[model samples]
Target: MTSPQPLPAYSRDRLAERLAAGPVVCGEGYLFELERRGYLQAGAFVPEVVLEHPEEVAALHRQFVHAGSDVVEAFTYYAHREKLRVIGKDGILEPLNRQALEIARGVADTTGTLLAGNICNTGVYDPADPATHAAVREMFTEQVGWAAEAGADYVIGETFRYLGEARIALEVIRAAELPAVILLVAGHEPVTRDDVDITDACRELAALGADVVGLNCVRGPATMLPLLGPIAAAVDVPVAALPVPYRTTAEQPTFHALRDPGPTPLPEDLPFPTALDPFTCHRYEIADFTRRARAAGVRYFGLCCGAAPHHLRAMAETLGRTPPASRYSPDMSKHVYLGADTRLRAANQAYRTSL
Candidate 1:
């Protein structure tokens, strides 16, 4: 018989202390990652896997930490009641949220990592419906409560397309007395779903007590980087940047809006959620993004959808960190054809270009 794992013990209010020290990196994109690992359903995107496969969730948190993330965000990006109800698993909401926080909490304590509890968009938001607004607040209250009860160091309310919804999440996190990191996912139009401009949304959220505020999700490096400058200038707080790892351009800004340049039509003509491989940025591109974001005043760095351990390592190396994964960063000199080592064969080295 196997022994039971010890309950996770979390330490609170550490995220503010971390930011006071310097720029910090948080690992995100748990939904896509777990989906790629065959443990999650992509379209549903709810984190029921936390209840069914706790070890897998824990292992991902450890991987991000090992790759140089300063924070271990709980795998609860879409664990709210609204998302659970969409997937017909509303009955398991409490257990799923608790399990995700527990898994993340345990992993965070091991490496002394900053633990972040996550809550994302609620799918159902209406500008005119008072009932909808109440529902959104009710949902955030429960998730925020679970995070606080689970000892979250801070809570991240991310990818809110509507500034109205962002306000609700911020209000709840403030009431819980946890430091809040609010990130808005502006679409291709440079405005939130509610038509509030991205910069104004971030600035207002910062004014409303978001400890860290900036852009995250939907858009990639190219499209997302431009918005950071204005938001950083508008707010005194540390700015966060966590774009998806894709090659988005001016004409087709967001990842969902990207059109393949290779002239071969994509199978679905929609390269977002699962078919975004061709548009994924190389690790070196991620490193370049890190350097540029730092220059643009983005103090909190991460990747959203399409994030992998290698991308996080690249970001860390750019910031002069040597996380455990840095041990294997490419050494081209070791290559048989491109060798600079004394033991290399002259003929193979000389044939590099032709081969």
Candidate 2:
């Protein structure tokens, strides 16, 4: 109910010192996951829950921390002033962001986890329009200042579709002297929304002084892996990938377009609207993605939309580390079953031996 006193700011050097320890596992997807849990309204997409329902937001942060997330990112993904204005609650932007940070900071402090301040795409990012560029800068400046004051260890600018806008965000975060990460949403394509080559864009973003640079949201890991190759090859800094947990195909690249007007399905009955069901990735699949990402030199791994605690646990297991306490675990008494492909391969090998 009361505002938290500002914490000491972390310098960029301090952030780098933390990163040098090892890879970081960040947990995002709060907006979509909350919507799935009936905490947020569909289509509205405002993170008003931080102000109205801090417990729900804090509970989510705790889940991620317990699921092995090293970073507890504040739920400010859509808390931008412009976004609040759409809902006629622009007056609450500062309170919403500050409160979100307070919740995350509390969890991080208790768990010894790092807190990341989240900033994302502003729909109006026109390089040619000076007024729009100015507005974007002002927006990020205000949001970053609030996050920094709230004791965020770093700031993440994610789900950006435009390179120009991403650059602006990186500039603002860097100017604050905090470590900055810029993640773009280019689907499976090798180009930005503005038609800039993704590989080239990664190179440029790194030059812009982003501590980390890579992709998030839009596509799932299978589709996002190939895209990360060029980015890893391009940047010397650590690369991050937080893809959605859906089986995204070439046809439906972005998750935003996957929404339907039908009623929300129960959690037990996920991957509804059978047409897009194939896009959903299971927990094991997320583990596989983590393995491949590590092989590709991606050190900062995380999940985006549809990600749950199970997915993060799987990722930790795949990395050959002990996972944090989880609500579910594999039944050791049951015989594990490999897929049909494995069975077919075994049969072929047996036949060859008999020959």
Clashes of each: 0, 3
**Candidate 2 residue-wise lDDT at 12:** 71
After superposition on all C-alphas, the RMSD of every candidate to the true structure, in Å, is 7.4, 8.2
For candidate 1, the TM-score is 0.94
Model 1: worst 10 consecutive residues (lDDT sum):
3-12
User: What would the TM-score be for candidate 2 when compared with the true structure?
Assistant: 0.84
Worst 10 residues of 2 by lDDT: 332-341
Q: Taking the tens digit of each residue's C-alpha lDDT, what string does model 1 give over 3-104?
A: 323122333357777877878998898889889999998787787889999999999999999999999888887888888888788899998888889999
lDDT of 2 by residue, 197-275 (tens): 9888888888767789999987888778888877998988889999988876566566544544347664444343233
Q: What is the C-alpha local distance difference test score of each model?
A: 0.87, 0.81
Total backbone clashes of model 2? Answer: 3
Q: What is the lDDT of residue 342 in candidate 1?
A: 66
Global lDDT of model 2: 0.81
Overlapping backbone residue pairs in candidate 1 total 0
Candidate 2 to native Cα RMSD, angstroms: 8.2
Scored by lDDT, model 1 comes in at 0.87
Clashing pairs in 1: none
